[model samples]
Target chain A: MTLIAADFGKLGRSTLMSVASMLALAILAPVLVAALRADSIPAVKLNADQIAPRAIEELTGRNVTRDYAYAWRDLAAASESARADLLNDYFTGFAKDKLVRRIADQQKTGVRIRYIDHGHNVRALFYAPDGGEMQLVDNAQLEIEIRDGSKIIYREKVNQQYLVLMTPGADRWFVRSLDQLADHP
Target chain B: MAKMHSLVFVPALALSLVSSAQVPTLQVPARLIAGQAFTIPTHGQGEKTFYLLGPGSVVKRTVELGTEVKVTGAEIAAAGRYLALSCGSDGCSGTDFFVLPGDAVKISFLLHPSRVPVTAHNAINATAFVFDQFHNPVLRPVTVDFRVLPKNGPAFTKSVKTVQGVAWSEMSPAAKEGPVKVIATVGEQEEPRVIQQVASEACNLRIKARRTSKGVEVETDPVRDCHGNAVPDGTIVSVTAVDAQGRTTVDAPVKKGIARTQLPIHGSATISVASGVAIGNEIKL
Candidate 1:
């Protein structure tokens, strides 16, 4: 939490005390709300124009978008809480292994990350003929905060690009890979 | 190749710091290999906390502001975007960079249709995704070799080009009914999958009949499929005989490549045989 203390030296003693308290609370309230509230589903728009071998069925398109949103929500929650089990629902294979390792590493180094997801524009690049895997390019908007315990070390808003791979499981689509790209189309 | 991605930290909370214009900028490589050690030169004085965030890792350390900060290769082994941040009393300055994958050394191969009929066309599919040692997909194009080794034919190999780390090819089943092994190769990595090619519908299912003590003994010649493959033993073969005693039918299982059955017939009799969708020649006795 940050309070406006720059101008407090010029103000009166009592006024300065009250103003500092108000400023601290005002800034602290939003941070608390943002951290404590449950992560809502982020908007995910999928474009399958380039998918090959088989055109994406309408139902598959709907299901993939909804599941991708759920994955983002879960990812945000997992990163903030450093809870690896939370990823089991929507993550599998390499994606799950990497995030789980990251959480473990975070706990070791006393570091944490928070992702405030905005939305995503995902383009489907490849769909295996046998329906085992799908590759996508995702352009995402997110606010990321790196923290050392209660101290916010760095925060930024980024337009990130990711190479994503999703595989179908028994009940839902699982994210197998989510690799950040350097703005390549 | 040296590539770099830089991120200037923008405020996420209400806490505003020194204007981004005044915040000290640091020097870092534009691009890095997936598993290589690197350093960032810091400026100013005093000690500051350095945090390196990347895929599958979060590294934090305290270093003297003016000295070079050493980052181990294991800290940022995963390929993707990485952020290097230095936090001091004045606030933090963050820069982002990219880590590209190494050469394609591994492959995840998927072969479909574990069993198919010999008559099927383009029934086997092989799709392979190339990867680095760290399990990151290699975005660059590469050629994948698909080797087909049939149970009873000369083996052949075909090459396909990967698009965005994935390549696929479809193959027709060999005429000979047996198992075919398909192997996908990338660099030194090889993955193999096997699919069975079973016989198609049985054809040339003609049977000969002769009078026996108990009844008319009818036995079929060797049953072969349209592709000339011997029908597998235990396949059902139906035999029917018609006489003054009305019609008699017996469903017999082929054993030793042929099926034999007895049907009680009186006086003149007509006999016929069938297997699957193929009908055999009729015999009159």
Candidate 2:
């Protein structure tokens, strides 16, 4: 009888473990799917071979690339949702001001835009001697969509060019200026 | 990209986009310049929603179909890609355009090392960032005029063509130490920065010793730099005296212009004075 009781206890523990695992999976499934469907950061290929004044350090290059990708992600999210707060992390100075104002305009007119970024090929144009500022040109592959209320208004895929200026602050790089060029691939 | 009046720029950008139709369609001008107003043509009838998006500007409003939609200069002062959309019953049709930055009229100048030694070689960095009136970086190759003015020396000028909106020049502080003013100009805009060129290391340090009742007293001649400028007061001057017993050293600060120290000993000794990289003559007492 004692051996039977021990066997029953092992069965009970095993059942409990199985139930817990199933419950955990069930609870996390939606979140996992949502995260996967959420905005993915676009790849950025940074070419620093021709930067003047000084060469970029490996760590700096990595940080710049990561931060630039994050910036684009935030830009897409903020423009789509009309939430200016998302831009505060990676945009500063005139860049932030412009984006925030655009968000406000969208709120006023109930217009929305979303950037579906594919990737970017960026070339380093200038690097300040003191490392305070860096400028680059980015050729981006993107699919842009504009919406009005519940209606989809405009959509297109294009290879766009941009002139970007970044400054270091708070242990990261901030986009000070992001201007687009009229070049097509 | 003509020079449009600044007054009409705002209204042009304000009405830059609109379309009228059950299925909206719009056509934008081929060329747009920052801080310049523009007009666009739209198709369809009745009222429709207009939206314009750019790097630093966003415009959204209702517009009457078949009429011109104008954009204001203030609204389009930032240079970048612009999208103009017109939404109607059927769907939305839009056109995209690029706005080039206007001529550079401002210079943001950065000059490093506010204070440098006269002997420093290429220690002054002068970098100029050219900008349009809208504070947009000018991308074209504009010439930036650089003038370097040094106290007690001839002033010279150099012109550098900007690449990617920036131009830089490195300068060596003149041999005569004083204030050096660096100026950068783009079009009608000028930015000037000042740097102080101070004396370099002490030179020709000399020491004199005289017999005192207790021992020997040593003093340095007025400490001067190689350029004959008196070394600033409070500079450390080391005095070392060696005798039969051992060596006695006194670290003294230059007062007025000279440094003095007293060695308390009974016998004769050799005294030497040194300041910075300059070693003075030794004296036998």
Candidate 3:
């Protein structure tokens, strides 16, 4: 009985040692993997070409360009209701009303106006001293197609200039107003 | 049968005489401007009704024949074709007229390249469009005055007449760097805009290198233009080091008026600096 109890105690000690060693290995495995990863991962080298100037004008100009692209994309939808719903995400007040009215009138007249924004070149016109508002002038080229009763009536390429007003939001920016700087052809 | 025929014949004869005696005529101007009041002359005898229809509005009124009918600018504020019809007891007549845009009340002044390098030739373009209060482009000849005020120089002024409501002028930026105010004036209306005149590319850029603990430290002298104006901050300055091993280049931006970079050199390296098109001196250590 003594021999058997002594043998059992020895076995218990060995088993505890094995469990403790496994626990330690489990704890150190992640550290070892991380160190290996650190060795394999190369250091980040700064590329001169990748560095961009953080100018407010350039940043805001990009934002305005993107907003104009989105707005024009929304305006070219085939369905008036869908166009109105998408435009509400970008426009407000008189500009929204005018666009909605234009779409409604087109629907009533069985006419559709589609715009394809080729590109936009935006320049910062004015930024408020307090950074509350910014105005940008966008020179864009678009391919406009007018359809009547499933037939294209007219198609033309037009270069348009727009005066865009942007107001900063907490996380992003909002377009306050958009007006045509030049008369439409 | 004879009595009925006599009755019809007598009434038909009376109607023909009335129509012949009172012939309606309308006299109106060939063209009218939006937001202007005018009177229309007519000729007839008896009570007559007048109707005016235009692009966005319609007006109706009753007046005695031969009396002039007055139309207010508000009733004809829209620019398009207008029609006036007069219906008298005997006959009716209609006349048409065209409405032109009103006088200039606003101006949209656009200056291209809101930011330009100082002393650039013909780099700034100012374009102006005269607009009426109703946002219609006034397609009439008008003189636009462009005034450019530099931060620390004499103001430059130019006048250009508009063709088809557009006027534009190209001018060079000033020597000094700062905000340049551009103003466009048409009659009593004025529109002001600002263009940022930044320093031109670094000229005569030079640098120096010295031994540091890490390896070698390189720094540029105050980068200045040909006219001795300090180059603007955030302008890039490239530093390159070539050693026995290979070459390494660091494009550092000017901060606090100068650019500084630390290069790790093994031994006997040559270092050179440049800013834009201006190349600086080289040092071997």
Candidate 4:
């Protein structure tokens, strides 16, 4: 009986030792892995050649340079011949002295144009017939904003309402002028 | 015969008592490495019960599913003469089994650069985890593997770059530009980071055959700043590039308001701006 008890005790001791050792190994595994992590490969970097073109094209298209090209032509012509222009025409109850004074003041103060970014949503004003005339009544909706520093100088939506001079000879469209729509500020 | 029996019986009784008093007690010391997590469960039912005991008389440790724990130490004490461990929960019987410490949780988090658009020049930002086995993001010297394999063209792989502690890589450009995969690894962490990348996004560069004041020109667009924004003249700019093999190559000095070396071919150049440039309103290239 004594012999049997001794043997059982020895077996129990060995079993406990084995359990302890196994536990020790388990505890060490994560430490070993983390220590050796530096030998592992780092995340890779790729060339940006593929993504740049698409971003540039997308940004350019959204800015409306090609679409509003006709706006420049109308503004340039009307500004030169202020007498024939409706907004500048003296007979339309609009005074040339006020118009010239505004132009002279703009030249003196260097009043520039700018765009406003209304977060994700954008709204703006443009002018009729390329935006050269100073008629405050003929503003249209603009697709984009023209800016000068922090100030919003012009927009597309406002001018688009009064004048439909987008097509040059009913085909090509260009911005005739930039001064059609002016920001209040 | 009675005297002899008495002598033997007394010794036997004393020996039994002594043996019973010599129960072997044990306590195992352990620590959970930082930056890692582990899980341990002990369950018992009916007469057979199990108890997972820890330090500070803490009992009935509940381990939820998907939860990880850190082990500090373990002790085994019993009343038997043998070194047998008995697991018990109140009235339930308990068996002493080996408990392993959690080790897998210690590995660092590796990350991959997000998908950026393709540019004339190709570059990407990649990073690796900066941690040890203890789930601590400690700074350590590590080997990093960066790979940029072209998806459409020839296969190209770069040598492993050695990084110290945690640092970002310079802009790396590729000769051939197209769809490609970027992979990074550090320690046990692989591509797609446990954390963010160290480097910034690679710049997209292009060479345009544009109408210049001097004549028809094949050069990078002047309107777009180093960041590729349409800026007027006099905007300060800087451009940097890295190759496919993780080799950084900065261009020679920029003369005449242009800041980068132009490739003879029309397409293929990745550019990134570090500082000093503004985007203009009109085509101000």
Best by TM-score: 1
CAPRI class of candidate 4:
incorrect
Q: How many residue pairs clash in each candidate?
A: 6, 19, 0, 103
Q: Residue A36 lDDT in model 1?
A: 56
Q: What is the C-alpha lDDT profile of model 2 across A1-185, one tens digit per residue? A: 99998987978988988999999999878765432223588899999877877789999899999999999999999888888888988999777887887888888878788888999988777777767788887878887777777767667676776778898998899998887765420
- Model 2 alpha-carbon miss at residue A57, Å: 3.1
Docking class of 1: incorrect
Stretches of candidate 2 exceeding 4 Å from the true structure: A1-41, A149-151, B1-24, B204-222, B229-285
RMSD of each: 12.7, 9.0, 23.9, 39.0
TM-score of 2: 0.75
Q: Mind sharing the TM-score for model 4?
A: 0.21
Query: Which runs of model 4 end up more than 4 angstroms from their true locations?
Result: A1-185, B1-123, B130-142, B152-168, B175-177, B187-189, B192-285
- lDDT by residue (B125-238, candidate 4, tens digit) is 443333333222232345665555554455454434322222233234333323355556564655532211121222343333344444223344443333443333333344
Model 1 stretches astray by more than 4 angstroms: A1-39, B1-23, B204-223, B232-285
Q: Rank the candidates by TM-score, best first.
A: 1, 2, 3, 4
What TM-score does candidate 3 get on C-alpha atoms? Answer: 0.51
Which residue pairs in candidate 1 have backbone atoms (N, alpha carbon, C) closer than 3 angstroms, thus clashing?
B3-B30, B3-B31, B4-B30, B4-B31, B5-B96, B7-B96
Steric clash pairs (candidate 3): none
True contacts kept of each: 0.41, 0.29, 0.00, 0.00
Q: What is the lDDT of residue A124 in candidate 4?
A: 20
Per-model TM values vs. the true structure:
0.77, 0.75, 0.51, 0.21
Error of 2 at B171 (Å): 1.9
Lowest summed lDDT across 10 adjacent residues in model 2 chain A is found at A30-39
Off by more than 4 A, model 3: A1-185, B1-31, B36-76, B82-95
